[model samples]
Target chain A: MNRVNIVGIIVLIAIAIASPIIAGSFFAPPPAFIGPEFLVQIVAWGLIIGCIYVLLASGLNLIFGVMKVVNFSHGEFMILGGYVSYWVSILVGLDPYLSIFVSMVVIGLVGVLTERVCFRRVLGTSKLNEIILSLGLIYVLQNAMAISWTDKPIQIRSPFEFVTVSFGVVRMGLDWLIVIGVTVLIMAGFYILIKRTEVGRAMRATSQNRSAAMLMGINVERMDMFSFGLGTALAATAGTLLAILAPITPQAGAIPALKAFTIIVLGGLGSTIGAVVGGLVYGLVENSTIVLLGATWKDAIAFAILILVLIIRPTGLFGEKEA
Target chain B: MNILSDLRKGLKTPKIYLPILLLLVCLLIPLFGISPYFIHVLAVTFFYISYSSSWNLLAYSGQASFGHAAFLGIGGYVTTIFTIQTSIPWLGLLLGALVSAFAGILVGLTCVRLREWFLALVTLGFSIIMVALTIELHWLTGGVYGLAVPSLLPSVNHYYYGMLALTVFLVFIIYLITKSKIGLAFVAIRENESEAKATGIDVTKYKLLAFTMSAFFAGLIGAFYAHFISYINYQIFHLDYSFWPIIISVIGGIATIEGPIIGSSLMFCIIEFLRVIRPLVETIDPVIKLNYPKIQVLLMGIILVVVVIKMPKGISPWLRKYLISISK
Candidate 1:
């Protein structure tokens, strides 16, 4: 946008790119990096994790855009989706991948219900109320899941668990490929829904201006529910993927949720493309930092980036509104 | 003589005397020869009052922190490390507050310009980062296993009295600040930052002051908590620590002097009641018995949702209004 901003962006990019090199050489030994093989593996891991974040964060961005409400409990819905998929896999004997659709629909309904029941009344109230309400939902949902399913981490064994895919030098698991593929498919569907459909137009219109959209005969209230549901469905999809990737515990959603929030903020509060880019960058940075600094620094690195970004551009990288 | 008369005149009013009466009642709880368990609960109640009041103070300035446990954990760890190193409990407590205040100022500097959700997330991030650092620097912080701290006072009675005294003093100071011009500036900023800035208020200064003060008290209580619990750990930074104050403040009243006290007392009582009746309820209904541990949190969530929807101003103000109407 300006010379100073451009300089800042370039500097940040440089630091991000150089961090792995710095970590490998300066902090820990370079033995962890078996040359380009590890690098490719890290890149692949980053893409998969980044895609999950993209799905999670874009949902958050979508909800924030239309509803102007930041759902702190969105991650719980993701976990709920994971649990639903787990149960569906166990009971219905369907593949976890196939049951993801069921999880999405179920969690989508829960999201809409949550919006109507809890969030609707506090929609235009103080931001504190919305935050508190979501915090309450976090306790409710997490505890509910803990009570029902217990806090023990449950892994959803994917049907493709035994299969592995190799792309040139980089080898990947079939589950990772499927997760990434599903993420791309969902994101593309989201794009079409937003850019091509009438509901998408309504959602976009409402996000642009609520009262104006209301004046134009759009049911802004219903659109709020729809967007919230859709946002949550995306989060649930991420959770379903996460279950396949790793164990899904009740409290497991908190960190990823925080990361998703960081991504949305980094990209811009209401920008879908910003979320995707931010997620990718975050995933890459996080994985690379783990490579360099070990796993302990992984969580801190994302927030450090967030704090740095906020200090430089409080409105976020692509945010339209002033901080 | 004149000041004494003015004080006497102020005490003649029910408003002044009621709180004084309440304070006396609180002090006499230790005198009533209550069981050690009850004393423990009372001490914890006071702890929550102190913590929630500090949280409410920040919220009064229109800055609701989601990760206040950051300050709490900082204070706890600082006090533990300091006292372990120096064996001076009082100095450790003071330094803990100072360190937390300093950290608070840094966080506030980053967050003062951000909006509500961003501020909350950033603060939450800081708490998470603090936890990470604490775990990473296990050589110093004892890692997740946590470090034991010497008690401030050996006896539960002494500890109860200490907490009560601190609570009373801190609450008085917060009361004075909220009633003063600085408090007015805080309210102004909370209501409309631009208007306050236009009116010559340095928005950053007051907001940072609120953050510093809130963190100081939180740290003080955290130091006390470490001593009372006889251990300090990264678990102090848990979300439960953060959420408890919010629950107390929201239930009691937001932006009110009496809110945190009432909220903390009520919540403490409810939690205690649930604990007492849990076994009985379990015997009656095996289903509830299975979920008994989670019921308190579930109820808190439900109450929080109900309060936000039905009584956003909280129960304290509603009680005040109802009482006033009844008297009228």
Candidate 2:
């Protein structure tokens, strides 16, 4: 195995072995695996957030792959989705779970509009122009949301709030179960779309080489729009699930979005598998940091890891060597 | 010989007189008995001018920092904590700037090899990490509650003149650097790194110099502004602080000396004017009234978008083109 693989495996094994030893540090170690242990519960929470991060990272990777643009404003889409889902839940009286579709459709359209309006103008421009333009979009979208929602924290109640399932020491709400299931299904669907379908082949072609894809009857620009829309739709799905899981404010997406930047970097930019692995690792590290250090340090740890990762492996774990 | 020749050539230009003329006019504005609030508003413009220009210099040097607010926060916090211990305000400001510059060098070392997005992410992550660090070690820093900073300047007019002078000094030095050989190296690296490297420029050294200098000015500005406001907090490290310089630089013109100056003044004018007249705007309609604050910020976003799309180089060049055409 490669040194990196060996390192990852060792860390995973270390965590597995460390759990019993680390259990002493918890507020209360479970004498018998019953109701819900805080230690296990925190890890479960990490996994859920990690699952959400996976969705975000995948969407980002998909978009980056096709368009080769870093959308700093992707997190804003997630927040907008959450708001839309909230609106659907309140206005249409739809379940939060079902309202994910409504949000995806709504945010998906917005994403396409953003792709056509903002990103298209600056396509093939310098990387600086793309980044600066994304910053402006962030400013526009964030403030618009603040105007509509007034920065109040809102949560949509899931129908399965009371239902709980226990896996050994870890007990999770049924809603958590659904969030995990939704992410898996969505990811699987995305995998199928990219791996099985003609449209997916076209997208792959466009990402692989825009000029060649164009030569092969692919509308490269259309693929760009499709990838962007799909990426944003997935982000919205994560947002809806997160909003149901916890209270979400208009500005809440910024942190997670920034965290996703670190995830993409850790996984290597535009690498799907890297994003998944990086997301899970980041989420686990972040939650564990919260428990090990203090809550204040949680947000900072991901960034520290990002800088460390970049220093050690500038290309990231899964990224191809720089062109 | 080159320096002497360039200095002579620089002084002979008619463009040199414009800034002098403008400064003279600005110096007299407070003498006209404008409201102290108006002077404070103008001071804010000056503050942002220095702030945005710091980012502009780094951008000019081929690095774009998304977490420059980290340096700013570092300046503010170090100065605050230092002054609180020693009660030497000037020394605190100096230390704040210097500490941040040192920190900048450290960060620059790690990120000098990284490309644009990687650099941006690293810098941004650095800022986020700083926020966490400050909050985590709140015993000295006051954590989220934040400690009070000693107000450096005595009055509104003093702050106005003081900031104006700082802005002039900072911009002038930046202007001089951009004119020199070092600035040319920065430009070469920015345009095409391989070509710059082939031309025998030490890429890492120049990039580090840019990082150090950018961090110094940003830190200085951060401490000075925090002291002007008489407050310091972890919130000072927020994205808004980082984004302001970027937005202003982008709006005014990236990589140009005058771009940030023009941009910051123009943006702050719009922001302040909107804020000042928000009540009047609120009276226009119920929805408008309800969302006036949001609308104010939203307009900034829209303006930034329009500028990025319609005038990518920014308002400075756009305005210069119009002026040149009209004169012609």
Best by TM-score: 1
DockQ of every predicted complex: 0.75, 0.73
lDDT string, candidate 1, B73-114, tens digits? 898889899999888868888888899999999999999988
* Model 2: how far residue B268 lies from native, Å: 2.3
Model 2 ranges with Cα > 4 A deviation: A1-36, A167-169, B1-13
On residues B1-328, what C-alpha lDDT tens digit does candidate 2 reach at each position? 6877876786896656778898999899999999998898899889999999899999998899999999999998889999899888689888999999999999999878888888888899899888887886879999899999987778999989989998999998998889888999999999999999999999999999999999999999888888888888889999999888999999899999999988887877787888888878778788777777778678888988888888888988888888778767
* Model 1: per-residue Cα lDDT over A1-323, one tens digit each: 45644554455466567766775586567664468988899888988889889999999999999999989998999999999999999999998999989999999999999999989999888999999988888988888988888878899988779898888987889888888899999999999999899999999999999999999999999999999999999998999998999888998887788889988887667877778877877788888888777787788887877887788777776665656
Instruction: Tell me the whole-model lDDT of each prediction, alpha carbons only.
Output: 0.88, 0.85
Report model 1's TM-score to 2 decimal places: 0.95
What is candidate 2's CAPRI-style docking category based on DockQ?
medium
